[model samples]
Target chain A: MSHNTEVLDQKTLWGGGRSPFNVSYGKLMIWFFLISDALTFSGLLCSYGFMRHKFSDTWPSANDVFVHFPFMGDAHVPLLYVGLMTFILILSSVTMVLAVEAGHRRNKKEVQIWLALTIVGGFFFLFSQVWEWAHFIHGTEAGAIKDIIVDGEWVTQVVHGANLHHNEYGNVLFGDFFFFITGFHGFHVFSGVVINIIILIKVMKGHMDKTGHYEMVEKTGLYWHFVDLVWVFVFTFFYLV
Target chain B: MERDDIIEYSLDISHTDEEGKVIRKRLWKVFWILLAVTIFEVGMGFMFAGVAAYKDMLMYTFIFLTVVKAGYIVMIFMHLGDEMSYLKKIILIPYCFFIAYLLFIAISEANFIFDIGWVLG
Candidate 1:
């Protein structure tokens, strides 16, 4: 019994009782979940790349498509609004990491402040996405005229905006992909805001303090950072590329 | 199996002022790097507009810069850099392989379809 107790004492830190990766169970699970989620996103992006490559000649340039800024009033500025959106998301990511850092210090006030900032950033990004999507669906004033067969008769029609079946943009797949990817990413940001709000409430209630740890905030930070990371890819592939 | 035992073992909080400063510095550095890369990407996008000859080059550059940005976000912001080296490898290696394989298949298959003129012709 004495020998066994001595071995246990020496191996306490490395024992099976602790995580092999030095991460808590919740954190490890979050990492794994993020990895799987990344694969799903990559799958979508790859399919988009394939379709874009296949329609290279007729692929609508993103610059020409996403050129509206709020209150800019028909002044064509390409990539500017999306650039602002990217800045917002990246800034939010910084604030989120700062929150995690403050949590590590057990500074409830700092954590709450940073978390609130993150939620605000997330709301801004989500609203921006809504505005961008509305512009995409509304399209430009001139629109595009295409001949389509209706009831066995070829008829010429003007299509102003985008839908699932047709787009004033060059290719139909362009609108589809845009809606799918950005809508999906927007959904993620919304969920992230909800999660951040929950975490903030918990912080306000001193739940983390009661537990004597702030690991929950860290887990939510991981998730928020993942959302930001996905936006980085989407901005590159969908807008810039 | 007590809650205190779990907290004591699992918490990796930095208690030192110097350590906190170091972490904050690193985080801000990463933020600056991400910002610079994004601005560079937007600038290049503007410069490459209507320049058909440089389309391929622009695409490649954007991809490269994006990968760099992703690296910073994943490593620093996600705290992967502070994890065990083996843990880092386990998370990153599979993603590297999966992305490469998917890109290869996507590019080659799309090229083949385009060459055949199956849809466009």
Candidate 2:
């Protein structure tokens, strides 16, 4: 513990006390937290693979599991919708970088405007996620449903909601893990939006330039980008893989 | 503090233009690199997507590329690359270990549970 304390104490003054590693306290913590959180996510995805290997025969494919959009009422596009989501997220990350750049130039208005745009992008991403979850839960009327007994209660499940065989995308465990992983990731993006909002608020109120610091913005940019990075993995593993 | 040394915390990074539109040249270069990398990823995604050969291998390769691209964006674009290599190593090497450890434990435990379900139940 003493050694640990010493390590932290030594690092507490990094970046000549100006940078403190890219941004400030909020973002620094977010990065460290995200690294560990990212590890957790990697673990979850790794388990997904293990389970997939065991169920190689009957296990549903990713393309079949998430085929259609909710309320679209027509058409099955395998990667089309997810590809769009990826586009939105990547664009938002670009805007976040722009916001950080604007801050670096000391252009408050530009920074504020860019931040607002990023927030809009974040909200759009969240809305899409909500729809995805809703589709996962309720499924479509066209697909076959399953009844499984849980604790003396009968529960309904979607069996191949995306395909003709009507094989459940996963067993109860499948549904459980899917919800756990994706939902957790979505929550991170949601919380990130919340943080961006707070940062935007602080910028608008003129708090950053006062102390001769926009490390806050820089740090937040790191976090926002990290969120985007994790999604790339999610896309590859959950969708593309 | 001297004017030059006094870090203006304001949003104004402009040293030349009156409107404060100035930006570092490196930002554009980084943006272009990121875009190029994204295009490559999309290409790989489409290419391997239809073919069944080495699906796992392709996915792992893409993941490795993503990690590389993300690290570059953080290091070069974000200027962590400019810092002493020692510091960069300090931050990154441990996180790699953690990811591996988490991957092993989580996957093995999950498989273990699934196995027990089959044998005992």
Best by DockQ: 1
Q: Write the per-residue lDDT of candidate 1 for residues A23-107, one digit (tens) a residue.
A: 6678789999999999999999999999998988888999999988889999988998999999999999999999998888888
Please give the lDDT score at residue A28 for candidate 1. Answer: 81
TM-score for candidate 2, residues paired by index: 0.75
TM-score of chain A of each: 0.91, 0.80
Every candidate's chain B TM-score: 0.86, 0.61
- lDDT of candidate 1 over B21-67, digit per residue (tens): 88899899999989988898888888787688988899899999988
Candidate 1 residues lying further than 4 Å off, grouped into runs, are A1-15, A147-155, B1-8
Query: What is the Å distance of residue A4 in model 1 from its true position?
Result: 23
Candidate 2: misplaced stretches above 4 Å?
A1-30, A69-73, A145-147, A150-167, B1-50, B76-78, B101-121
Candidate 2 i-RMS? 7.8
